[model samples]
Target: MIVVQEQDFDLQHEYAALRQDCPSIGAIVTFVGLMRDFNDGDNVKSLFLEHYAGMTENVLADIVEKAKSRWNLQAVRIIHRVGNLLPSDQIVFVGVSSAHRGDAFSACEFIMDFLKTQAPFWKREQTEQGGRWVDARRSDEDSAQRWEK
Candidate 1:
């Protein structure tokens, strides 16, 4: 499942939906990203996220497909929120279900790594100084690269 919206999601609801009717699923792993209060030495008041609609969903679906090709996954769910958001608000969710903990854990991490580097979303942070467009971090690239090797 791939969801891109402006409203907040219920984590438990999503998890349940992923595991539903999958009696073979013995493990489920979920990752939720949240907006922070500070970033790059600035005290962030809020965050504004924008995406290219159809293009964003297509990329996310591709990321999920890659995860499925690499793991024995039973289900996968991804949800990313857009528009203005405040600190501590949920930003994204990645959930993976499988018959074993290892697959669930690895696939969950892999999906998030790809999502961070591959997704076409622009972010701007609001601070006391002004709103600034956030840059892609080298750490994020490194994290995604580890999966290639």
Candidate 2:
């Protein structure tokens, strides 16, 4: 499952929904990204995220499909929030369930890695100096590259 929305999500609700009625799933791994108070040496007041709607969903689905193909995952869920957000706000969530811990862990990490680079979401950070478009971090690219064949 993939969701791109402007509203905040309930982590507990999402986790419950992901594992609902799935007795075969032995392990579940989840990752939640939060907005920070500072970035790029500035005090960030808020963040505005924009996406290309359909394009963003397609890319996210592709990332999930890749994880599925690589692992024996029973389920996967990705939720990314857009629009104005404040510090400590949850920005994204990725969850995976599998028959084993290893599969669940690997798939969950893989999805987040790919999502960071492949998802078409642009971020603008509002700071004391004013708002500026955020740039892709080299660390993010490196993280994604490690999973490449």
Candidate 3:
């Protein structure tokens, strides 16, 4: 599942719903991304997020499909928020369920790493001093590259 919305999500409810069926789902991994109060040395006030409508969802779906092709997973869920948001808000979530812990762990991390660098979401942050656009981290690219091996 892929959702881009302004509303927040319930992590526990999502996990529970994902586990409702198939006892073979032995391991479930989830990652939640939050809007931090600080960016670099600036105290963040709020964030404005913008994403390409149809294209963004298609990119995420393609990533999910890639993970599915590589692993024996039972279920996968991804949610991302767009529009104006405040500090300490939920930004994104990724969950993966599998029969084994290894696939669940690896695939979950893989999805997040790829999303961070590849997802075409633009962010402009408001801070105590001023507002500025946030750049994509090179470290995120390095993190994703690890999975290529």
Candidate 4:
């Protein structure tokens, strides 16, 4: 599942949903990204995100497919929020379920690594100096590269 929405989500609810209807699954891993009050040595007032909804969801599905091909995943869920957001707001969520902990953990991390680097979302950070478009980080690119064959 892939969701791009403006409303916040319930972490507990999503977690429970991931575990639902999978009696054979033994592991579920989830990650939630939150907005921080500070970034790059400045206090960030807010963040505005934008993306073509259909494109974003399609890319996410591709990332999930990659993970599934590499690992024995039973279920996958990804949710990313766009538009104006304040500090401490939940920004993204990735959940993976599998029959074993190794598959679940690796699949979850692989999805996030690809999502961060491949997703077509744009971000503008509201810093004291004014709003500025965020740039892609070398670390993120490097992280995603490690998974490549």
Candidate 5:
């Protein structure tokens, strides 16, 4: 599942729902990304996120499909929030369920790594210093690169 919305989500509820056993699911991996209050010594006040409506959802769905193709995952869920958000708010989430722990771990990481670079969302941060556009980190690129065939 790929959902891009401005609403906040409940991680515990989502995790419980995702972990409901079909008996075969042995592992579930989840990642929750939160907006931080500080960036490079500057105090971040808020973030303004922008994304293309249909296009962003399509790309995210494609990423999830790619992860499913690579792993024997039972379920995958991705939620990304858009619009204005404050520091310490939930920014995104990725969850993967599989019959094995290894596949669950790898696929969950793969989805988040791919989303960092491939997803079409841009963030502008409000800081005490001023507003600035956020850039994709080199570390994220490196993380995604390691998974590419």
Candidate 6:
């Protein structure tokens, strides 16, 4: 599943949905990304997010497909929210289910690594100084690169 929306999601609800009817799944792993109050030494008040609509979803779907191709995943879910958000708010979710913990853990991490570097989302953080456009971090790129063929 791939979702890009403005509404907050219920983590438990999503987890249940992933588990439903998938009796073969012996392990499930999930990750939720939260909006933080500080970034790069700046105290952030809020954030505004934007995306390229259809292109964003397409990219996310490609990421999910890649994870499935690499692992014996039973289920996968990814949700990313856009628009204005406050600190501590949920920003993204990634879940993976499989027959074993190793595949579940690795696939969940792989999906997130690609999501951070491949997704077409833009962010601007509100700070005391002013709103500033956030750029992709080199650290994120490094994390994503470890999975390259």
Could you tell me which 10 consecutive residues in candidate 5 have the lowest summed lDDT?
A: 13-22
* Global CA lDDT computed for model 1: 0.95
Residue pairs clashing in model 4 are: none
Q: List the residue pairs that clash in candidate 1.
A: none
Give the Cα-based TM-score of candidate 5 against the true structure. Answer: 0.95
TM-score of every prediction relative to native: 0.98, 0.98, 0.96, 0.97, 0.95, 0.98
Local distance difference test, per candidate? 0.95, 0.93, 0.92, 0.93, 0.91, 0.95
Show model 5 residue runs off by greater than 4 Å.
Answer: none
Candidate 2 residue runs with Cα over 4 Å from true position: none
- C-alpha lDDT of candidate 5 relative to the true structure: 0.91
What local lDDT does model 3 show for residue 138? 88
Query: For candidate 2, lDDT tens digit of each residue in 28-92?
Result: 89999999999978899999999999999999999988898999998899999999999999999
Give one digit per residue, the lDDT tens place, for model 3 in 26-134. 9999999999999898889999999998989989999999999899999999999998889889999999999999999989999999999888899999998888999
Considering only N, C-alpha and C atoms within 3 Å, which residue pairs clash in candidate 3? none
* lDDT score for residue 128 of model 1: 99
Give the TM-score (vs. native) of candidate 1.
0.98
lDDT agreement of model 3 with the native? 0.92
| TM-score of model number 4 | 0.97
- Candidate 5 lDDT, tens digit per residue, 35-111? 99988788999999999999998988988898889889999888999999998899998988899999999999988
lDDT of 4 by residue, 1-149 (tens): 89999999999989988999879999999999999999889999999999987999999999998899999988999989999999999999999989999999999888888888999999999998999999989999999999985
